[model samples]
Target: MPRFYIAQPLAIGQLVSLPEAVAHHIQVLRLAQGELVTLFNGEGGEYGATLSDIGKRHVSVEIKTHQPREVELPFGITLAQALPEASKMDWIIEKAIELGVSGVQPLAAQRCVVRLSAERAEKKMAHWQGIIASASEQSGRNRLAQLAPLQDYKQWITQQDMHRRIILTPRAEQSLADWARHQSPQAVTLVIGPEGGLSDAEENLAIQHGALPLAMGPRILRTETAGLSAVAVLSGLWGGM
Candidate 1:
């Protein structure tokens, strides 16, 4: 069944008019009336529905049943990622959702190649949100991952956090896998730097603010690869995957 993220209230026994974007998708897919589909409102669970109407530019569905199924990580893992060059941030955010991250924080770190102005930042944020929804639909996740606004590295690192913050760096003696091996599942914020990695001063400041620095491995991984790899490693050892 085709799964869609409806950004509106959804309940059983109610007819819902699909949004324009989702309607267009259904038209493109050439779906017919009476076809069963899946819909989730990001509230918690998914609902089963059947296409009741398909107009030229609109569509509606009749909700039939609700499924309290969820595929979220046992521990809340937030990916605090530094902006990278080109469209890598888009790819990173999409994969992060697929990996079951609870949240994503985009940071403007020192040595970051790409910088977003105020106007562009607003547009990029909206674009990233769509990616999150699409990824969730494909990944079978009922809940949408939280997307934090673009923030500066210096300010974000110093803010008080409810969860442990772990920064990935080569300077660390113990690897992430080694550290996670002895630890149990818990909420953590994984901080990943940009192309050249976080500046020494920034790393020191993070350490002073209670961020744990851990190496990914002996080999150096790019900014896009580090966070996803860390999540995979954690899921492997922590039993989330």
Candidate 2:
């Protein structure tokens, strides 16, 4: 059965029309009347629905039953990443969602190669949000991940208040595994830098503001790979995986 994020209130016996994009997707999928599908409104659980009508540009479905199911992790994980080159951020967002991150924050770091103007950043935020929703639908997440607005490196670092916060660094003395051992499996925030990684000043600033320096392994991972790897490691260690 196909799953879609409807962004609306769903109830039993209610007939609702899907949005244009979703309608187009249904039409393209060639779903016929009475076909079963899944719908989620980013509220809590999902609903089972049957296609009631399919027109040229609209698709309507009837809610049949509701399944109070949730696949979220026991603990929340937020990935605060420095903006990378084009397309890598999208990939990171998709994989991060699959790995059960609760939120994502994009930061502008000193070494970041891609700099987005205010207008461009807004457009990119919208595009990344779409990626997040699609990833959630495919990953069976009833609740969508929160996308924090773009922020400056110094501004964001000074304001984080997560129970556990770690910044990925190749030179950190503490391994991620060792750091995870002491964590309480609560909300964690992982900060990853861009291509060349965070500068010494930036790292110092993060450490001064309660972020622990964590090393993934002996090998240094790329900007996009570091956060995902850290999330998977933490999830597995903390029982979120």
Candidate 3:
């Protein structure tokens, strides 16, 4: 069945028009009236609906039954990722959504290559949000992951208050396994640095903010790979995967 993300509350037997972008997709895919489709309200639930009409500029659907199912992780995982190159950031957001991250924070660290002004950050966040939406549709996720506004390293660290916070570092003596042994946190925040990784001062600041330095392995991973690896490990440990 075709799946779509809607911005409004969905109730059974209610008639609703698809968003403009989704309308175009329905038309191009030739989804006819009376065809069944799945719709999510980005509120962690899905609805079963039938295409009721295809208008000139919109497509309408009649919601039949709501599937009260949510594919959320047991423990929330937020990725505080240092801004990478343009294309790599896009890839990271898409995969992060697929892996069931609750939220993504684009951070500007000492070694970050990409810089975003306030206006540019808004635009980039919007672009990354679209990537997340498409990834949710592809990955069978009903709720859309949140994309936090851009923040510099210091600001990002100051704002986080997660139960467990881990910064990915290759030289850290503590492995993730050691950190997870005694602590059972409701929410976990994982920070991954950019291409050049986190500077010493930045790492120390994160530690000051209650973030434990964790080594993924002996080898160094790219900025894009580090978050996904941590997410996968954490999700499995928390019984989400």
* Candidate 1 residue-wise lDDT, 1-241, digit = tens: 9999999999899999999999999999999999999999998999999999999999999999998999999999999999999999999999999999999999999999899999999999999999999999999999999999999999999999989999999999999999999998999999999999999999999999999999998899998999999999999999887
TM-score ranking from best candidate downward? 1, 2, 3
Better of 1 and 2 by lDDT: 1
Backbone N/Cα/C clashes per model = 0, 0, 0
Q: What's the lDDT of the predicted structure labeled candidate 1?
A: 0.96
Q: Give me candidate 2's TM-score against the actual structure.
A: 0.98
> What TM-score does model 1 achieve against the real structure?
0.99
Residue pairs in steric clash, candidate 1? none
- TM-score, predicted candidate 3 vs. hidden true structure: 0.95
TM-score head-to-head 2 vs 3, winner: 2
Per-model TM-score versus the true fold: 0.99, 0.98, 0.95
lDDT of 3: 0.88
Q: Which wins on lDDT, candidate 1 or candidate 3?
A: 1
**Runs of candidate 1 exceeding 4 Å displacement:** none
Off by over 4 Å in 3: 181-185
Candidate 3 lDDT over residue span 38-147, tens digit each: 99978878999999999879899999998878887877888989999869999999999999998998899999888888899898988998998899988899988888
lDDT of 2 by residue, 1-241 (tens): 8999998889999999999999999999988999999999999999999999999989999999999999999999999999999899999999999999999999999999999999999999999999999999999999999999999999989984845778999989989999888777888789999999999999999999999898999998999899999999988999987
Local error of candidate 2 at residue 70 (angstroms):
0.5
Error of 3 at 131 (Å): 1.8
